[model samples]
Structure formats: C-alpha cells, structure tokens
Target: MPNLLDIELLRTFLTITETGSFTRAAEEVHRTQSAVSMQMKKLEEMIGRPLFERGARSVTLTPDGFRLLDYAQRIVSLSEEAAAVFSEPELQGQVTLGVPDDYADRLLPRVLQAFARSHPHVELVVRCEGSSSLGERIEKGELDLAIVTKCDVGEGEVIRREALNFVGAREHATHLADPLPLAAGPQTCSWRRSAQHALESVGRKYRVAYTSSSAAPLISAVLAGLAITILPESAVRPEMRVLTERDGYPALPPCDIGFLRARHARSAIHDALAHHIVTRIGNLSPAVLADAAE
Candidate 1:
C-alpha cells in the first residue's frame, strides 16, 4: 500500500510554514523541536521531496512544499469544517477586537465576513488603533482579542509576515530631493520608527512632510507626491510605487501580524473568531504578502 499523508503531519507542516520556524511551530503543536524535525523528515521521506529549505534560524518552503501547501490547507480546512459541523456549538457572545489602522482596510473585512458566516450570533466589537496601543490594551485585559503588528517575534499564533516597503506616488520624483520628504504616523508606530531608523542608518537626510495617525491621509500624502512612507507592500495603494535601493531607499526588516487573547475565561465564540481571522490572513494575495508563515 502507498504511504498515506497523515492529517496530523499535514497540520504540522502548515504550522511550520505559518510560524516560520520549527521552534515556534512546535510550541503551537505541542511538540518538541526535535520531534518537529523528525516529523518533517518523515513527511519528506514519504513524499520523496524535501519540504523546507533549512536555515540557521529560519526555514522556507521549497518549490514542492509550496505546491503541497495548497492541498494541505484545503484538506485541513475541510477536516475542521467537518468536525465543527458535529462537535462545535453555535457560539454566541460579544467579542472585542482591535486592529491597527494600516491593517484595518486590508484584513478587517475578510475577518468580519468569515465570522459572520461561521458564528452569526457572535457580535464583533472592533477597535482600530496603532499596534502598540492594541498590544497594551490586550495586556491590560481590556480586549477579548487583538491582531497586532509585532516588531519582534511576538506571542500568539503567527499568521502573516509583512515586509516593509518604501512607497510613494508613481512617477513621483520626490525621492530625488536632497532631504527626502516622508509621510508617516507618530513615532510610536513601527512603520515610522523603522523608516526613520533605516534612513538614519544610511545617513540620509529626510523630513517628515506629513504625519497622520489615520491611513486615509497618509495614503493621500503619498499619492499627492508630498512624501514617501514606509508601509507593508499589501497596504500600498494602486497609484503608489515601491521605492527600492536603486530608487534611493534602504531595505527594512520584516514584521509579523500575530494575535493576542486576553488571559481570562474564553468562549467558543472567541475561538471561532480567532480561527476566522487566521484563515482570512492566510488567504491574503501572494503577490503583496511574502515570507508569511501560513
């Protein structure tokens, strides 16, 4: 008989991909790092192809691994759906969620739609704030759940990895200015801090021509060629273009979108909402979202 792909192994594979490292994936799957490594070896042996390209500190999917990911995700999702139909309850409660302004437009709608379909009785109270503020609220037990952009490897299930890009209006020569014009949020924002740090590292002279806590005006400033700003590639507007090293911008570090659940009593409703958020984030457009775990 042909060796079958175990559901548990597939789950492990998805976890590893989503978390970017075996160590993190093991924590989520309740396995030791060596055990996770052994599982990957077994899966690769059964499939007759290596699944991940191992790095000293991180791992990336191989081409064959990427191909298998789609089927694995579908299989896992269908399995969950089947189980939920029989084992899950009709969850009902008000769940408070917080998201950063930059991600609100990109990730919020899908999460809302998924929750609406899966647990219609659950009411979603969402707060839009900077990631730093959201993290603080989650820590203070003021929220049921929050999706936050972490500057470092943060707590909770890792969903998506975001590469910060320097973006501005298309055909805009604002970057050519001696003291580059920039539009950014307050210093508390990771985007602004990373942008400034990158510029200062290279000894580049820059000026914050526009600042806004909201996404609307920041995008407007970039579109109007008033300044360039650091943003995740997914958040870039249609009229905006990413400025690269050749375009006189420095590379920035990658960040992640992770969730934090309050350390209080949980409900089936909360779990359902969290699941929906993860699924939606995993389904983001591949072109813009690169190096994500799931």
Candidate 2:
C-alpha cells in the first residue's frame, strides 16, 4: 500500500505558507518550533523531496512544494467536507471577517444575504476598513478572514481580477488638469500607488488633491469634480467617467482581489463562509454581477 499523507501535517504546512515563518507557523498550530521542524523532516522523508526553501527568518515553497500545494489544498478541503457530512455539526459560532471599505457598498449585500440565509445560526461580525489595515489585522490573527487588494509584499488567495481605471465625473475635465488633482485613500492605498506609477510612466504631472480613508468621501470628491481618482471597474458608478488611452491617460494595472485566512483559526463555520464567498464573489458571473449591482 502507498503511504498515506497525514492531513495534520499538510494542515501545518499550509499554516507555514500563510504565516511565512516556522516560528509563526508553530504558534498558529500550537506546536513547538522543534516539533514543526520534525514534522517537516518526517514529511520530507515520506515524500523523498524537500518542501521548503528556508530563509533566515522565513520559508518559501521549493519547486516540489509548489507542486504539492494544489494537491494539499484539495485533499485537505475534501477531507473537511467529508467529515462535515458525517459529523453534521451545526455551524454555530461567531466569525469575524474584514472587508475593505472601498468595496463594501457594492459587494457586501450579496455576500451577506446569501451567507445569512444558509447559516442563520452563525453570528457574523464584519469590520470595514482600508485594505492595508485589514491585511495587517489578518496576519496578526485579529480577523478570521479579510478581503484585500493584492500587493507585492503580501500573500493571499487571489479570488477576483478587474481592471483598475482612471475615473472622473462625467462631463468633467479633471483628468486633464496640470499636476492633475487626485482624490484617493490615504498614502497606504495600493490603488494610489498604481495611479502614481501609471502617471509617472507617461511623464504626467499629478498631486494628491484630497485624501480620505473612506470610499464614500473619495467618490464624493470625484463626483464634485474636485479631483480624479482610481477605482475598480465593478466599483465605478454609472455617473463616473472612465479615462482611456484616447483621452491621453496611460492604462493602469489590473486590480486583484483576494482573501487571507487567519493562521490560527480553523473551524467549520469559517470554511463554510469562505466557500460561500468564493462561490458568490470569485468570478463575478454575469448573473451574479447583475444581481449584485442591483
């Protein structure tokens, strides 16, 4: 018989990838660092290949480890699903999820209505904030899961991609302003970074004309023609106008939306909610997107 891969070990392995270090992984798994090391060594011996490329303070997947990633995720997810079917435990617990304010108005209602209908017993707590702040909260285990805008220095499961656009109010000439006036979230925003880079690439001048941590206020400034701003395609209101290459604005990078799970929290409710989110929010299918827009 072929040797069976231990689900617990794979679970630990996934934790390490999310947390970025053995020390943090051990903390998440409630194991000592040495025990985590031994588990990896044993797994290596079983598989006849090394899984991690060790850094001074972090661990990245080796090529072999990357090969195992999809398999591990599927195996673990299926195992949990199978267990839930047999055990049939009522998913009754409080789960805290974070959502970036930039998307809250447009995306939250659909996600909430679907989840609440199916799992009424589960108490859901939501924190609305900037993606950068939410990402930090997720890493520190303050949030059970968080939706974030993908950035280079962070890691998450990218679930959706949409074009990030240069947007101004319709019938406004804000995009053509000299040292273009821009409205955006605070300095930490990824969209702000993309806007700056795109402008710099084409030798365009711009200044931060307004800054707000909340999307509502930022949109208000744009609609008032105070400044132009960046927004995901799905988030752009009908009243807003998109700036295109024909308008002399350089194209912006595509925005990636993804989720991060808390390294330490594993529960049926969490998995169920994650599944709901992926099914409902992942692709933005035509029907789902249309309904969500309503």
Question: Which candidate leads the pack in TM-score?
Answer: 1
Scored by lDDT, the top model is: 2
TM-score of each: 0.74, 0.65
lDDT of 1 at 155: 65
Off by over 4 Å in 2: 1-89, 284-294
Runs of candidate 1 with Cα error greater than 4 angstroms are 1-61, 82-87, 152-157, 282-294
The digit string of per-residue lDDT tens for model 1 on 29-88 reads: 999888888888998998899877765544567888888887888788768866775677
In the range 1-294, model 2's lDDT, one tens digit per residue, is 767999999888777665666777788999998998899888888788998766544456777887776677667766765675557756788999999877777877767876776677899999998887888898888999888887732788888789999999996878778989999877778888888998999999999989998888889989998899999987999999999999889998898888889987688788888886775566521111110000
Model 1 Cα displacement at 62 (Å)?
Answer: 3.5
Error of 1 at 141 (Å): 2.5
